[model samples]
Target: MAWWKLHKRDKPGSPTGAGGAVLASAAIITRDQVRSVVGKGQEWQAQAWDFYRTVSELKSGVRWAANGCSRARLYIGRVDPDGSSSPTPVDAQAEDLSPDLVARLLAPLEELAGGQLGQSEMLRRFSVHLDIPGESYLVGFDDPTSGDRRWLVCSPSEVTSAGGGGTIRVQLPESQSARVELSLDDCTLIRLWRPDDEYAYLPDSPLNGLQDPLRELRGLTSHVLATVDSRLAGAGMGVMSDDVVPASPQQTDGANPVHSDPVTAALIEAMAASLRDRDSASALVPLLLRVPGSVKDKFEWHSFATELDSNLLPLREAAIKRLAIGLDMPPEVLTGLADTNHWNAWIISDDSIKLHLEPKLGLIAEALTDRYFRPAWEALGVPDPEAWACWYDTSDLKQRPNRAPEAAEAHARGAISDAAYLRELGFSAEDMPDEDEQRRRLLIQLATTNPQLAPAALEALGVRLPNIGQGAATDAVRAPVEISRVAPAVEAPARNEPPALPIAASAVLDDGWRMACLDLAARRALARAGNWLLSRSGRSRRGELAHVPVHEVHMHLSPDQADLAQMLDGAYRDFHAATPGETDLHAAVDLYVRRLLLTGIAHERGLLAGHLAAAGCDRAAA
Candidate 1:
């Protein structure tokens, strides 16, 4: 038999430490049998029964006993209630390890084996889980009976498997060491034992929230980081010491210095630098999307596209995965390589005989559209057909002297549209509308009318027209179209009414000064006309006149000099009087011819008339 007793150090009235057998006296007995002295079924008596019942299930009594009861010893340390002396520790005589105790200990385990309850099921009913902090980690558990339901907090890293059922190791809250193992063979048993409270921690569990869909990008980030580390290592510091540079120091010194291989920091800086050309930087997106490991943190593609001008190229898994899993960009947007026309021109238009153009890789979708796709349209081959008429207005194709004449003819022949041509120059048709088309047409018309316009006009159109005179052509191709002889002017039917004083011819003329007002009026008008052609479609302006209206067409006059009309007028009479046979047409004659042409142009511009009487012809006659 077991006994309970207090040691000599225990306080008065405390039972002897080994008097465990008698410790289960009236105080320990159930109140149901104590109604004679105590009151009938009270709340306190009910609570006592519940506690005893719970304890009884966890223990088993031993029947065979050999000796008399041995008292249990207890030790109680003195306590200083006012902190006058010291605090005391308390200990009590422990009860016997009876059969009821054994039964209680195995109660959950037996229930688990019998398919009554599960071993380790998630407790999802409570607001908060209780975590006992240890040296390095925290262990969490469900609080039973405190709230409406129970909860069990487990490790997120732990994997729960249902084999021959599962196993849950229940731990005691007071001691970090306490535990009880239970095996549940039936799924129903585990389900029934599940708690109702919700238990969650920071960074929410996968079930609590969707895990980062871009987690796979972490691999790419790691690769990039590794590459960056190697690059940085290779770029040696000014001073070489014995030990390695501290990583923290490297991180703190944020600006990345350029080195042999591009580090991630340098690459990122490069990307940022590209953003300065906001338009072109968009091209980097496709390339960047392929960079693994948290690439999402590096750039926001949509915002970047909207903010910067660039091109993009989809290279590997990183970019493709994000396309499928995260972003909603369209397929055309993603693969928007430059149009065929521009690409072909860029690659073949050059005179290198073997063209080499290499674009950066891993660009984003938007950047790809802007940088690679748009510019590539011309070289890639024109996409549309109707834009050729005004192609010179918005593109720079016709000025390529090195380009094959066939290509220039192709442009002039409406084989390619302005939009297609610009697309070849890496421009997008999405934003450019029909209004732009009309504007482009007007500008081209203006440029074509100006004979004095620079070759840059054709360059803007993407094709340079080679100046091939009849002498340059093969003899077999000297074929000429029959021209009608100068016929007398035919009279037109007179209008019944005179035309209204047509909104002042000045309205059609770009220059405001009239011929009567200034001697330079004609020259000024000519210059104004040249200026008008040059300004039209080279760049864009949004306000004021949306388009220009024309009243009369004044074709440009060709001459080597700027004031060709004045030069030509000065040489006209002399050149006309020179006797065709008598004059020795030597090198000086060629020079005189050039001067005559120049003077005629200047005369037309109201400058000076040509004095073409072959040099000393007039003086010789005198």
Candidate 2:
């Protein structure tokens, strides 16, 4: 067989390797030996037949048979996941066998099975690491010529060299049972005198090999073994495949095993029913939206679902009514919710809940329908229900101060202010894509410029105003004005120290003379007639011709200087007028007086305050 080719250099299988060598030795034995030494009935027969088959296969090559005979031995030990020496195997299933007998069988194996082979090679040779100490193995051989399957029981006597362990040999009685109990500690290793190299033997084939049959068997066995390993690793206690096995229970919560436990099935049904009965659901809604096929098998769960189906109309009505009341809407306006099936269908749909909630929105609906209202106007950034109640003292967003005006106004005006408020709250006009900015602007203009509004209030409202966290308000630029800083004119004596004047010109000058001169100067000034000699004295040009300043001042002025400056302005104006666009001293003085009068009038009227301030003006400047 192909397995024989792979084992060409090593001793083959369990106690039978030593049995084959004994067959080669021509030892004599009996059928009672076969039964007592190997095992009973078919077990003994199978071992004997296998030993005979092995001998037949080796008989073709004397050299191969000689090599196998010299290297013959068998050993069994437990392996862990890490491929470490698992010195002792914990008893997963305790039996009623005597403890002392089990102990005496195991101590020798523990001392003998150490560092004989690499971990990987040992595992590759044996499919499972037999629990040597906690398991038992009865090993011996049969004589071929005698046709005897008699075998000897083996145990450790003492540890000799670190490599060579002395073992006890027991020749069994013909009447004894052959099946030995195995624990990790009660394991054994067979050794023999040979003329060739020593060989390590495994009872079972390894997991992966050129041998196809064993490879498949190893795959299934290893998977089961790994599961057991995992359970043992988790808890200190070990379990067998038959104990705590998978029950194939019904799937609930997507994790429970399926169709096994009645109580678990009932609990799952009740849970699913309660979830279905919920009026409002959030994150878990998606999970329950499509019930799992496994849960559908639970009749009680399906029965609970039936109750929900029958009562759905009232449930839908109650849910819609609650949403409407929260929205401060009347039930009639939201009649679309009366169809429970449609509502339920929409509930499970995507963000399309917007479509279902549309009719019930009331004021939100009106604002949304308006061409001037932006979609953002619906965002109303009203805090959530909890916050809304804490802040506004009610969950009703309609009763909010800003939204209160939405009800009284027609759809146009209501949409306008609503849109504006949302924009002020930081929403963009695009958020209300249906609403046009033109109508919004027009509404604002009408509110500010209406003839019916109070003038002052309307004026204040004409400018664009900033809202919270917005840019500064626009303001008008005003010109600055300069006020006279000098004290008002008061009388002061002339350097000449002249006598004080009378109250009237007649008291100082002769009445007849004062009247004749005032009348003559008034006529001369109007007629553009006067001498030019008095122009150099710095007297007014109008005064030089009109003589009014002289007439009034005669009472306040000394008589000696009165005649010192006389009508010379007219001649000066005439001389300056001779040159094109050039004014003489007299004309310039008169022009200056006229300019002053105009500027003073504007200052008194408060027209140039900012302009004068900008120009660095003093009291006389504007």
Candidate 3:
């Protein structure tokens, strides 16, 4: 239960001692709540968070995704491999990351993520805060030992303000009367971007974009619960009039007479839990009832799952897929690996690091580098402070299970190539293992085997094995790091200023707009879909501009080829039948639709103009 030395305001989580009384009672009054001190705002709304008890979609997906990036072993400062000050030795065992200062940073990072329990405990809270709220206000505290700053990850809602000159005002937990204004030298803010909003003071969570799907998920969940209750009540539903009573906890004491129905409810709940698998062959979900003798005859024994499974369970998966898309994660990452084969599951693990984790870890690492660690480095009067970048090693994320047997089987059956087999067994293409290690237990069968040597096998493929002579493995300080996995945190270029995109189709072309019947409901859905599309398709739309013809660009931008146009069309169809109502999302929807439509129109215009200019140049030459 080693805790990060957080600000004094974070006392509620502290062990009962000096701050015991405060921990028991003090309430955190944040900046959002401070607005209500003078005005009569919604007391419950201000006091409580968006979700008092987060369950299902938001809780599960966010936490699962966050876990991938939670245990980031952050290192700062990079020295060139060829440069002075601890250059990588001539041997293979040399440390890739030079400068002992950079290496020593791991200790403090471990302590920072180490919350009341273990290393990941604090990081889990930090990651959850970032994932759910879309922001983590890391209030910096000066480390007396290292002369650096360590941060306590605070909720965005809890921080009243983080203004100029390192002033971070945090809402004190428990029943604290006043907010605590901690005068700090450094504060790092990690923000997940809100779509099309460059100037928003508050950022958005990955969950924020998936609001509609989440609402559907929640609504569907409630509908399922109500349906279950209806079904459960329907069991002895009409027969409850005799001596039977709906048992409360007090009514259902310990014995079957007092609380047999709740126990029956518990059994039914367990049965329902077991049937969540989409491919479950179990058609009949049995409902056993314990009731009074008068009601026993009327009680209908039924299995609701097989009957209703086709209608409902798949809808939940659709919502879950929406969550996965919004989070930029693979659907299997959220739902579980039940649907995928073993090789695909293995590929998913690797893809989890590439698709999902790298971006998040890079963001966090960059923020820590720029604001948290760099400031401390500058304060120490170190030169080239900004040159030092916070980098992450995700060696831990790569769980290297013994895949040799699987690889051997696959390769033996000609299902995979030699290189693929070696890679499957966790050996890199460049720096690979020896003959015996690569062959596993099959070194004795080299004569029986086709390739007589791992070295000779690789030799045929033009891969030269580095001769370490002997004792080279024990001499290396750092393990042969996959250089791809070890990289500097790259901060995305400033996109605050709006890109000069094309005009909207609805406004320009008389018949350009595809969604003619879009109302408020469709508008929100359109906006969500448009934003989802925009978030994935980044600023590099012009990549195809150089190679392809102008007509191809138009076709690419068209609804047939353009993903945004397709998304807008789908959203309209999905929500066209909905009861319309106005929301702030509609405003964003309008903006996004315009932007998405205009982008294509704009590109077409530019390309057309260029094509005409090229033709004119040829005609003038003629």
- TM-scores for the candidates: 0.15, 0.12, 0.41
Better of 2 and 3 by TM-score: 3
Question: For model 3, what is the alpha-carbon lDDT of residue 219?
Answer: 74
Give RMSD to native, each candidate: 38.4, 42.3, 27.6
Ranking by TM-score: 3, 1, 2
RMSD of 2: 42.3
Query: What is the C-alpha lDDT profile of model 3 across 448-493, one tens digit per residue?
Result: 2322254565654556778865543221211221111122121111
Across residues 98-203, which tens digit of lDDT does each residue of candidate 2 receive?
A: 4643343333222222222332222211111111111122232333346343333231111111211222233334434423322211222222111112222212
| Residue 47 lDDT, candidate 2, scale 0-100 | 34
The list of candidate 3 runs beyond 4 A from truth reads 1-52, 77-122, 142-150, 161-181, 185-201, 231-310, 336-339, 403-622
